[model samples]
Target: SLSLRPANSGKVCSKGAFNSCAECIVSGPNCAWCKKLNFTKTGEQEAVRCDTQENLKTRGCSETEIISPKNIQQATQKKPLTRFGSFVDKTVLPFTNTNKEKLKWPCQDQNVQCQPPFGYKHVLSLTSEHQKFNDMVSKQFISGNLDSPEGGLDAMMQVSACEGRIGWGNSTRLLVLATDDGFHMAGDGKLAAILDPNDEKCHLDRENLYTKSNLLDYPSVGQLAMMLDKSNIQPIFAVTENVKSELQKMIPKSAVGVLSGNSDNVVKLIKDAYSSLSSSVIVTHDTLPDTLSVAYKSNCPGGDKPGEEGICDKVGIGQEVTFYVQVTAKECIKPVSFNVGPRGFTEKMRVTVTTRCECECDDPPMKDNPHCNGKGQVKCGTCRYDCEEGYLGQRCKCSAGQRDEEQLRRECRKDNGTECEGRGDCVCGVCQCHETEGGKTYYGTHCECDDEHCHKYKSLLCGGNGRCRCGKCECNPEYEGNACHCKKSNEQCKTGQTVCNGRGTCQCDQCQCSRGYKEPMCLTCPGCTVPCQKFGNCIECLAFAEGPFQKNCSQACPTTKVKVVDRLTLSTEAKKCEVKDSKNCWMDFTMEELQGFDNYSVEVLREQRCPEPPNIVAIVAGSVAGVALIGLLILLIIKALIYIKDAKEWKNFQNEKKKSKWTNADNPLFKEATTTVANPTFSGE
Candidate 1:
């Protein structure tokens, strides 16, 4: 019933075996996995050969472990079964998550998501039209309202109050601050600060109020991020205008995204972001048309922008920036709201984007190219016209005419000669269209369908995928599965997931546990299972009188104890002690003596205690938790040491990155990272 194996040498196991299977050997999943594929075993696992799993005995193992096969030959030689694929691979079917078919392909498929200007994957990041503007805006982003010095002591008190309501720190939330304009602190012109409530100039517009709105006479973005960081919130920034290398240097590398254009290019920039990272959009288009309905997401579902795009970080410095964002009359004039949605399986993010565009999109259309038909592209097109001396083609744009069986092969020579500069033959009096690969057999033909693999002129000649199946490209591995699509499964259960409780492997359409496991999904925690459960008290008492608590022998106690103590313990509780032979003593004192005792207080003392309270269960739980806590503490110390070691080695990594940033790295307007989660405790696990 129990088989034990020790770690060894000369055994090149991909994974250990659960039960004997030639395909598995010392390196494979449990026997149950191989059994499903129809494999059987005999003798030692190492002596077995590869075989399929089928009709095998179930394995005995723990209930909380997922196991898979380690080798193929073990299954075959041991558990001789065959639902075989090919002789090339004789390993047993594994229950593990390892890829059964490791197909060779060109590249990995990536998901698409809009970036910057939208989406924050729990990591704060902003998007803007230009990198310079992004840096400025990020530097000035206010995750929460900061009380102005003008407001005096009350202002400071207000910030403290805000921190209390919001909490000081949270590791999971990200705050994004972005902009597309030049950085400063005001809705109107040069803003000023009014520190006192009594200051008539404190109000906006009445007196350079724009300046006064800033807690600092001139609130820098670096200050904001640092404040936010104190609250455990991270800030990522995106901008347009120019790359603000200075800002990038100040913030964490992962918290920022940037664009090189202006506010007008927001849509295109968002669409081009990569989906592999966090993303956000800070729409600068204040003038939005009511006619448009835009779907804004905090984290770009399609994806965040690719590299060469921006990704920034934040500085956790203070707690004030973790509450309500302080907005001036300027921000009030433009309505802004944060809308978040599910990012998939516990993944959620917020999105902000500009809906307004000031540029006129209805300019005159340019003349279409005769060859490309105005697609703004000219990969393979032809012209038809006579030459003006050395010129030729449909528009006489080339030096000579061309012709070939492949329609695309016929092109006007630009060198003013036939055969395209005398280096090639002329088909239809034109040079052949070339490809990165070697020249094709049908040199003079168009890219349509060919009898073999090449195409002469059909669209998607290889079925859009690379390979040609039945004269058409059959999609590769992942592509072959329902559609020629990529899979997100390669990474396993997305971001927030626990595959099979990390207990057992999914095998043969069922879960297979390791050698010592057993359970529905192999999820049995190592502990005692008591039978004195409330729901099953009667049945458990009869069946498991000795279950988990027999040492006390309360169940087998004397009947008198049960009749009094047991009954009273449930509904009420009191205890009584009676003295025997009192009548004989009373006789000696006579009836009067017995009567005098009535004067004494007749009080009953009661004593109570529970057999279960603070019992084995408590000790077990405490002992386990104590051990785990100690382990966790040790792990933390080790991790800290490793980080310190790395920091000691890479102290200059920060400075080197700064050197590669935008030319305006020294701009004082560029601030460091300040990020915070407005409310930490508010987030529920």
Candidate 2:
């Protein structure tokens, strides 16, 4: 007769507040139930059976009488390790035909020539005999020529997918890829007009040869990694120094070895990589919700500290390692389970956890308790009224006619101090919500919620696609908006067969373009200048063997056709472009975009518009003549300044003579001069 109750305000596992053992154990992680019948005092409630282990022991409850549950982990499967390991080797060859004399043993011995008509030959399957495998590699394994960046990814996809053809057993599967160059990936098959994507399925012929090599695009890096992990296959890349770093970055949890010039140390490299990978153990866990956090501590060989993501390195065979996992719940949560195991192993250890939330009480109702005015019964310390309808109050003391209206109205009022949130009236200590004109009714205990209040779009509520809850629209999966008006599909944002011409993202039925592309569908780039200037460096590299793209001219401009012409003529369809060369000379070229093709046709003028040779003699003569003219002009300017200064002096002298009291001849200074001369001789005669 156990009953559930809300946890009281106290320590998570304080006093005995639960009745049954299950309820006590579920109340909190620290809580334990006391099974002894005489654990409680005479007046104590039956809920006294629940308490913390320490409190229960302090109260004289024996350890055996306590019930507490802990987190658990179990391993369901354990298979014996297999002895022989399966290996798949992928070799990439250049597109150019090698000379028979210079060709290596396997390629030349098999008489396999190169390039456009390339094919594959499967020589061996997974075998246990080492000598037989070596003989196949030395005699039967023939090299096939393909385009560089080779189809190594395609081969990997096949090896991971076609398990039956490779005869893979229940053991460690290894894929060894030996190459001297990079690999082709998804989106590269478009160059050969292969529109089909890799399906990640077996496409091997009866002879165990990959049949869809040229018919499908190579698998993407992510796809290859996922398939490798799913198949439990470990990849070891033996590549040249050029592509070693790239392969390491592209494939996680994979080993990459740098090969020697002749690849003579491949065996040693493989052995070392295998040893290193086998000695380490990395434990990983499944996805977890945001409320729970997990930490791991392991007794590994290294002095690894606690909470280091469960990594133990330098572990030897037959050695046992112990891991201590700690799971913490940040918030109140229900039971949750997850699996954790070694990174490359298929077996996992399942861990399950349960949280404690509510308490339980087991107490029968007492008949006609006095506290209820003999109109109710007492159960779990609370009074349950059996009075007539409309009775209220804790003891059923108040009825509809005798109810305290002010006190009851307070109970029906919302948090905002409004009665029924102004949507209804308070009656009998409860809210009687009103109905709207549109037939929508108010909900929630305080009548605070209505369906008609959600957002609207185009005069339609929730855009006619979603339901309104508590004044917010909960949009359907296909549509997302404030009013559920925007569709999640991108079909309307596509131009022709491509979405936004592959240059933008579709959002809210509109194209958000990238780069310099413009929208409706991102098909136009109005700011792109002349074709020659746009692809000047590529054209310069391809036509004249010099520019920024000199080393990768083919990749820079893959489909541009260039031809030398005596002179470039402007046509209505072809645009004339003048580009400057490295020598600061303009090279005229007429470029036309071939209709229905992604290539350009260019006619480069044979002669560049270089500046004519400088006329040194004419320059020197012009310099001398200009210097003479400047000298003559300076003399004329000086002569005119002298004449103007002389005329100004004469005018000033004439004006002074006209304004003076004495004439120029009879100067006032003449008498003064005569007097001064006389005074110098005879004192002012």
Candidate 3:
């Protein structure tokens, strides 16, 4: 940033203004270590030091007020006048100002003003606090640089950076400068007098001081001239009195100069420069009254007749003169061109243009740069251009280009009358029309716009009538035509089709698919049956239940995304389910299963009915497994039968106990009687 060098710039610094200066390092910048700021050079080999900047004091500085150039010169609002007219205007100027004391004159007279040659206002203390001042100047010059094709943006920004803290208008440009920061000698400062290339000093000291440590590395005073010519800028260079020689080398001889040792001197230099360069006509060259006089001097030097004073001659080819000239040609005449200079001479041209006329005119003659016959009116009714003629902004309402008829309208009009619609353009009371990047031009009385193609845009720029504008196919901001067709895509609604596959109406360009359907394209339906498929996976709901959708079994086979190569039907084993199951679960003998059932097939009940239950191995395995189960069941039944028999025997035993109870009472006597009467008791039974 010190000198705005590119990255890796130091490696390339072998010659030119950059070599001797520390090459403006890209990293580790310490101004003290950098050779540019008179920094020390000892540690430079080991540790590179860049221009280290101190933190700037950024806040709480009083702002410089934005001075409106027009506010001070309300009395001289119209145009600048010649010396004689200026005297009169000055007399009456103060009557309008309520604050008479504040009304300072821009200057006395055009010739009396002492201005620097080419330099205009240069800046000094336009700090961040004065950002408003910088902003104002930059705003006026911004133009359409935002959209400019080339150097407009960079030029505008750079010029704006150097704008004066105070502003001046078209009446005149003044140069005012103040420099707070001091400067150093950076490059070869040896003059041809001090060390001529032929001298031994030039040969010896070519590497330092007069050659190395000099101010030549900084942007030179000559560059100011180049910038001035390009940007129409004028400079007022201010520097400290101690570096007088350095400042002298840094400024063009013609530009305003200031040598200030302090801030007070700095202010005085600014005011002095402002006073000096406050007029349009500067004494760039001076010869004398005799040389300045012409036939007009014989009559009226300001304005007169033949041999009258309004005429002037200039330096032209083969006809050289000096000072300002005065000629006499009272009426309009044919355009005659001359190579304008002190030698320029022309007898026939009515218009005295500054291009060829080296007169006191601030501008080229009115006729040569004619915009209107009168002050604001166009000479004749003719449309010169679109909105691009001599203006800026959206519709070219402001002055940006060479002022032409369109520009004249905007300046002279007091009302709603403006160049473009204030949004477009005007020509002979009609809008010249505004065209956009897409070629849409405003139409109708008020510039209500449409496409250039109107209603038919297929062939026109806007389909010829479509009026393509703002990246939209439109009749205007509102109306629709051929450019905007009625049909619209329904993709936004997730319908994926333009017209709902011809089955649904489009509302707001959205498809409302018919009943029994869902999809962006409306090409699918939920009512479609899903096949009971086992190929990929089983569909439980369709398999377990039948519905209208699945009513068509074999006839209208259920459909799925998967391809079913083999038709699905009831299981083949279902027909043979009447047979007893081998596992006792079920028997659905399929033909394939039946074919493999040869030896392994067994009718367990028939095998058991064969009298021989099975082979020993089979019987053993079955007997072990079955007999154990049967034995368990039989053991359970035998336990039940034994329990029943025990109950019955207990009942009989109970009856016997009751009978025994009766016998016990007579047991002793009965025992003796029963043994004796055994045969007798059988006869009684």
Candidate 4:
């Protein structure tokens, strides 16, 4: 829906059609011109060469003769976008305030200021010098008082529409608008008694002030978006959190960042916004009608993920990307054209689409054609019958009597006695097969078979390896099965002495192993013993020149060809065996079971593991040391037991003495007087 109505919608293709293909396509997207020189009938208009694409094709126009112009996209300018270039830095003050301290810091690092005498002014265009820009912001500008809702839309419209005056280059253009409050829109100008709409023209006077600031109404958001798109300028709104969402919805592809209350992060915000806008490529098209939908798939930098709306993220500089655009029309619409390109880019791809609606071979009705049995009219080589009651058939010849109905029904019955195979209806002794929703139709005489109803393999009819002929697959020589799903080769079934090792069956070159039998040709039987143990001694003798068969190794291992290797690797077709020789050395070998012969491929490990001779000197010394350590431990245990017994006895003796009360009161009865006389003398002194 690139257009409201299709281009050239009012003009019919057959009315004033052009003779050539170029002129016909130019006239209308639906118009197709025929290249056949004698396509037109003698009395018909020459303009018959041009009509809807379907009409020409139906009117005996060959595919090569028909000139239908399809939708085309051409990139006119493929010049890469400039990586770095000059950008304009025009700033407009929405309203004036005497608070110079608050305003001074944000503007000091910026170039170009809209000063007062006027509410908005454009001065000192784009400049790179910091000193010059700072001087203009700090010294030359003066502040005054103004009203609340600002004229930001008006300033944006002028900046975008007047691109040449602002010095826009063919690079990444950014229009940074730092605002802490909401701005005026289309209807707000009525409050100021200014009803004139914004003309989107440059209005700077001699002193670079907006002369028509009081004369024009604020431009609507849509108008601002258009003007910005026309100039290929990307707007970055460094606004407060409160107004961010509303402004984002208003303008498509506009970046919004939260602005600090003091505007201290204005520079950082602009830098970040530029970086984000430059790195990503956002492809967008003009507005489309509801009947049309477009989807985009791309091999973007990250991965190929289709976007409902075209978007490629994290793109690097000079990296080429391809977009596959799919445009679907839900309903037939007239041909329309639109421009699609990356946002903030001047170059674009123009796409034109054409829709075919009808054919031109549709002729008017002719009454009473002889073939219709005088009861039907003919139109487009088909009969349209208006028969009396109980009449049927193409010529209205069959009667709906019981006998005729029964015969017709019988004719539509299949070999299985089902009428029309339950897939169609019997009409006047003929079966008309039913067509499926996917456009697959049953075509057998009794409606019993169809190509599409054939068995499928791997989700493909005939497994993409054969053709489906009347509901049956005709596979190639290399493949077989009902759906052509199996390979015909039986090479994989051959193993050792018998096919499938005599334990399973082979189908489609693969082994269908029986219970207890291993897969992959059924070479191994878990419950059955292998021949490796029987041949172990022969292999040991032949491979290692050891074991009882060593002397007659040639006769014992006559069928085996032994080869020594540093390491033995076991294989699925081979059985591994580790056997001990007469010298008690372990030998590792692998024997492959061969088919149609007794010959064997035997691989043996070169290095065998054998027991080392014992050291008698170290053994004797270890035994003597062990005996001495044991004796020392026994003596220590005995000493510890004696010490414990002695301590226990002493404790018992002390306890008994305490219990008897014999300490300090010796000879209490007899000797008390003698002892008390000696002690009494000392105590008294």
Best by TM-score: 2
Error of 1 at 442 (Å): 76
Q: Candidate 3: minimum summed lDDT over ten consecutive residues — where? A: 82-91
Q: Write one digit per residue (lDDT tens) for candidate 1, span 1-685.
A: 0011333323233433222332343234323222121111111121112222221211322222212322211111121111100001101112111232322211123233211110011111122235554454344321111121111111212222243222323223343333543343212112322232322222223221123333323234454435443443443444543535655565442244565555564434443322212333222112333433332212223324332112122312221111111112322123344432212111222323322121111213333443323322121111122123544422334433333344433443443334333334443433433332423222221222222453322354443434443244445444432222332232331122544445455432244455344554444434423111221222222223433334544443321111212222221112222221212110000001011111111121122222334588889999999999999999999999999999976877877877785654586897778866577667565
lDDT of 4 by residue, 255-298 (tens): 88898989899889988877777778878788988888777777
What local lDDT score does residue 452 receive in model 1, on the 0 to 100 scale? 41
TM-score of 2: 0.38
Itemize residue pairs with steric clashes in candidate 2. Answer: 16-50
Q: Give the poorly placed runs of model 2, Cα more than 4 Å off.
A: 1-139, 146-149, 163-173, 180-182, 205-207, 229-232, 301-304, 358-685
Q: Which rank order by TM-score, best down to worst?
A: 2, 4, 3, 1
Which stretches of model 4 miss by more than 4 angstroms? Answer: 1-116, 122-143, 146-151, 163-173, 179-208, 217-233, 239-246, 258-264, 286-293, 301-307, 327-335, 343-346, 355-685
Where is model 3 more than 4 Å wrong at Cα?
1-128, 131-224, 227-232, 239-263, 281-685
**Candidates' C-alpha lDDT:** 0.30, 0.68, 0.31, 0.67
CA shift of 456, model 4, Å = 70
User: Model 1 compared with the native: what TM-score?
Assistant: 0.16
lDDT of 1 at 587: 8
The segments of candidate 1 whose C-alpha lies over 4 angstroms from its true place after superposition are 1-61, 65-178, 182-243, 252-262, 271-685
Q: After superposition, how far is residue 547 of candidate 3 from its true place, in Å?
A: 46
Residue pair clashes in candidate 4: 1-288, 1-289, 55-360, 114-121
